[model samples]
Target chain A: MARIVVDPVTRIEGHLRIEATVEDGVITDAYSAGTMVRGFEKILKGRDPRDAWAFTERACGVCTTVHALASVRTVEDALGISVPRNAELIRNLMFCTQMVQDHVVHFYHLHALDWVDVVSCLSADPKETSRIAKSISPWPKTSPAYFAAVQNRLKTFVESGQLGIFANGYWGHPAYKLPAEVNLLAVAHYLEALEWQKELVKIHAIFGGKNPHPNYLVGGVPCSINTEEVGTINTERLNHVGSLINEAITFVEQVYIPDLLAVAPFYLDWASVGGGLPNYLCYGDLPTKSYAEIDSFKFPRGAILDRNLAEVHEVNGRDAEEIKEYVAHSWYRYERGDEAGLHPWDGETEFDYTGPKPPYEQLDVEGKYSWLKTPRWKDHPMEVGPLSRMLVAYASGHTDVQELVNETLGRLDAPVTALFSTLGRTAARGLETKLVVHWMKEFYDALIANVKAGQTRTFNDEKWDPSTWPATAEGVGMTEAPRGALAHWIRISGGKIDNYQLVVPTTWNGSPRDAKGRRSAFEASLIGTPVANIDQPLEILRTIHSFDPCIACAVHLYDPDGKHVHQVNVC
Target chain B: MTRESGTTIIGIGNLLMGDEGVGVHVIRHLERTAPPPPGTEYLDGGTGGLHLLEPLQARTRTVIIDATADGRPPGTVRRLTPRFSSDYPATLTAHDIGLKDLLDAAYILGDPPDVTLFAVSITLPSKLGTELSDPIAAVVPGMAERVLNELD
Candidate 1:
């Protein structure tokens, strides 16, 4: 057996180290480790519950608004605060915008290079690439001259001997299967997607104060709706949002979806690989009516066990029996034993690093290894993210989700079982983006209708004062981040946070082994994957990036006046 | 692409990590102390990423203020006009997309702004703190002044 390690995986949000044992070109065992630890949860202790969103929102720079959303929801739930319809609609719009933007950026910038060979694009015929682009969709930038210009620009960038972001890619690897023309087509769209993604987040800026770490309130949204006023969600601002929504929908449908379809057929074999765990989980989000109405969620909340799509299990966040986090193979110690599992309300963040120090060769996997604590749904190491969300919605008989999934499956000419692999995970994200852009239109219309009806109340200040509290309370706020199931649990006493825990998406997917010795999604997915070259394990990246791991959100350590943590030297 | 003629002062850092947040602190100081130059806008680009590409492309010049750890003494300030990603210092803060990568992406997409980076030297913080260290905080006014000079 040969051991291969890919430390500091490139193109991911934070630091992640993956070690896999390969036997005869196929991976037999895998280990996922989150190198950096963030102490955001520890920082939230003894702070005002209302102000927690502002601090937790800094947990990640990539998935900016999701943490704020979850934090505000948790506080609101604890305080029993109900926001107005306009506030709900506005929040829905922001959530959908994040989903659309994050998914597109992931497909084009973060995950595309694993499949596309930029070096191969240099050899592609511009006319042939243009023909292929035109045949895929009517995206308007498909002329032969347009492709030639893109090709020349790429040529200049490559010949400049300064690849920069494209510097570390395995460009000529045998694992890359896209034709030269398709590769060129993807490369052209890659640049276009980068330019287009920044525009969609302007919606967040208009509603909240800014894009990254946008302003949030405990009762409702921070921005008020006043069409006649200058400093609010005014008429011109609303019109700009409308146009941006239309532009986003067009780009996703015309460019993103078509590119996804054009590139997927070549790697259909991936549909059987990287289908990690048999169980899937999704805490549904994007409320159609109110958050209290769980049935009204467009995404549909549920879980599937043993890959059985025939039945969907309802998921409740407040139930301690359902969701529990175990740190048996993690760096932290639980007050009860290391093997004991604790729910979020009772979660602890005590540090006890037992792994080898830096400048070390390998981690002792037999002992504690990763910084991420293992999260399980009812003792099952369930997979989360786009694939889980799609599967749950499909099994729940969500008409739009079912129709889209079936149609895409038909196009690929693959069976329904193909929905369990890396290709399915990638395809589900694109399909979810298509669904969300339309939902964004619906949300926009609803907000405008409320404003026209002269009902523009965005905040509910009845319980804004802490004196009206019950002295002690606890609540859990759940939302579907672009990553997967995300929730923040809070316990408030004396109007301050007593204990707070955030089970982010990556924590569920990139966690280490549990006490039962069961592997999570990241490890299980790489079990049977074939690596063409041990030196350049592109296959490992393809499977891991499919989960779109964000380790910064998973492991946190905050010590404002404490001792210095370990040092990491990156080459 | 029609580029507007103006200077955009962008401060890139995380406000939660001690001296790593010096870029944002400098921008806040400049906003409070200095009057606005015509066609000049200040942006708090928290942990810089590709999202800054559009705003950068819209302007004629971009002055980026960020903290860097290049084995220099803390609070040392250096101004550089880096044309390529290779010209950047070894360590910027831990961002989703590094400043160098963002610049490279902007350049490849065309209409990239003329960028001038102000790298403030500091040791990488191991703990999370909202306030900058004393050495880094002492240079905030000077850093703000240096950034204002670039705008002029």
Candidate 2:
């Protein structure tokens, strides 16, 4: 068996190393290793539970606010504090903004490179590109002159011998199938999207005070709405935010959704590739009414076992019996044994590096192979992320979700089973963006109506002082990040965090084998993938990118003392 | 369209990784102590991959402070004015593709900004901790001063 490894996978956040064993041009087995070991849980020990959000937000650069949200909720859960109505609405807005921003960025910047061949755009006619773009969507920027300018700029950059970030991409790979005109249109929109994303982040900047690590308080939002107060969230600022949301919605409706539909038809065959674990998990998020009401979540939560969309088993993120992280094949020592599964509340973040040293040919797969622990729901290895959330919602009989999923599939003329593959995973993100935009508008309208009604209280300071504390308390803060089910478990004694554990989204999707040696979504998905060329593992990248694996959030900081911590050599 | 006249100083790094957070540390220092030059904009470009391109493109001159693991001694600081995307150093910590691809996108849009990167060299820490190493932490003021001098 020949081994193909993509070390430090490019274009995604953080460092990841994927090694697969190919037999007769097909991947027979795969191992994913999160090369770093971030012991945030260990560091979180003995700290103020109130300060956990700040530290946990640092766990990821892309999804910082999700951690912040989960951290605050964890504290709130421990204190049994319920979020006030306005704060819930505002928090939902923040969550929606992150989802939209992240999904758009993922499509255009991170994952689009996998499908669209940028180099081929050089031969595309600007006029033809403009025509194709206009035919697909009414994006007003579709003038021939604009296309010509974009083409000229690209031509000059190519001739200048500096592709930069585009430098190392597999530009002219055979897997790319988009027509030259379509490719050119995609490239043009890609540039436009860069500016579009800047405007979107302004919403986050307004609500949370900044993007990439917004200021989040434990009990409520940091910003208070005061129309008369200067420099606060007044009418003009809220209007500006509303306008930005409209702009984002317009782009999603016109540019993003159409682009997905236009390009998806060409990649229809990808439906058969990268079908990993059929089991799915989602912790529902975007509460419409209140935090106490789980049924009101815009995206419903449940677990789908063995692709049985017929029945979605209930998944309680807090229940130790339901959600457990297995460390059998991961590089960690469990308190009971290496092969034991532990709930996050009883989780341990101790370090144990047993993999073969770096620059080695392959991981010792039989032994501990990865830093990512296998997180299982109901003892089943599950896939988590857009696909899981989409499938769970689809199975739960949510009418809008069902209509969107069925309608999108019907347009593509794809089977419902197509939802199990890489293209489905990518398309799920687009559909969910539409759903999120709808919910965002709803929440925005609700926020405004609440203001119009003159009920302006955003924070509940009743549980603000930790000094009025329980001697011991433990609680789970679970939410559906843009990724899948994310949970933060915290135990407090005398107001200080006694133990903190996190089961982030990536840890679920990018997990290693469990005690039974069942492959994770990452591993199982690669098992049957056909490799055209070992050197160019474009198929692998496409599948993994669909999941948007954020290894920085999965694994923590690597041990400097470990000889192979940061020196994993790619072959 | 006439371009906006100003320098946008972007501090890019993963602040959780000890010394890798030097860039943000420098920016925070400047925000607290030094008054920025006229028409200067400051941004905390935390490992924010593609989101950074728009800000970089809008400015005429952009100064980025980032930590580098380019085999340099700990606490070493190097300043570079990259004319082309290829002019950037090979190995930047964490969000390399984000910044590199950003420049490429800017180049494709034409009139790529003049980018100056303040790369601080230091060892990456073993475990997840927020505290920066002594040597790297000590150079924060110097890095801030150098970034401020670039404002004019």
User: What is each model's TM-score for chain A?
Assistant: 0.97, 0.97
Measured with C-alpha atoms, the lDDT of residue B133 in candidate 2 is 83
Q: List the residue pairs that clash in candidate 2.
A: A37-A556, A37-A557, A38-A556, A38-A557, A560-B126
Error of 2 at A273 (Å): 1.8
lDDT of 2 by residue, B2-107 (tens): 4588988889876777777777888888899977778898888777766676678666788999877666788999989877655665443454356766777766
Tens digits of per-residue lDDT, candidate 2, A1-571, equal 6777787677777667788888878888888888767666877899999899988887777788889999999899999888789899989988998899889988987899899999999899888988898898888999889988888888887787877656557888898999888998988888888778877877777888876678898888889999778777889988887888888889999999999999999999899889898888888899888876878988887889889989988877678798788888888888798777888888998878898776576788888888888888878888889998888888999999999999999999999999899999999999999989878988998998998889788888888897777899998888878877888999999889999999988888887788787888888898898877777888888988999888777775332211112122233
Q: For candidate 2 chain B, which ten residues in a row score worst on lDDT?
A: B89-98
DockQ of each: 0.43, 0.45
The i-RMS of candidate 1 is 5.5
Q: Candidate 2 — which residues are off by over 4 angstroms?
A: A556-571, B1-5, B35-38, B57-59, B90-92
lDDT of 1: 0.87
- The lDDT of each candidate is 0.87, 0.82
Give the DockQ (C-alpha) for candidate 2: 0.45
Error of 2 at A169 (Å): 2.3
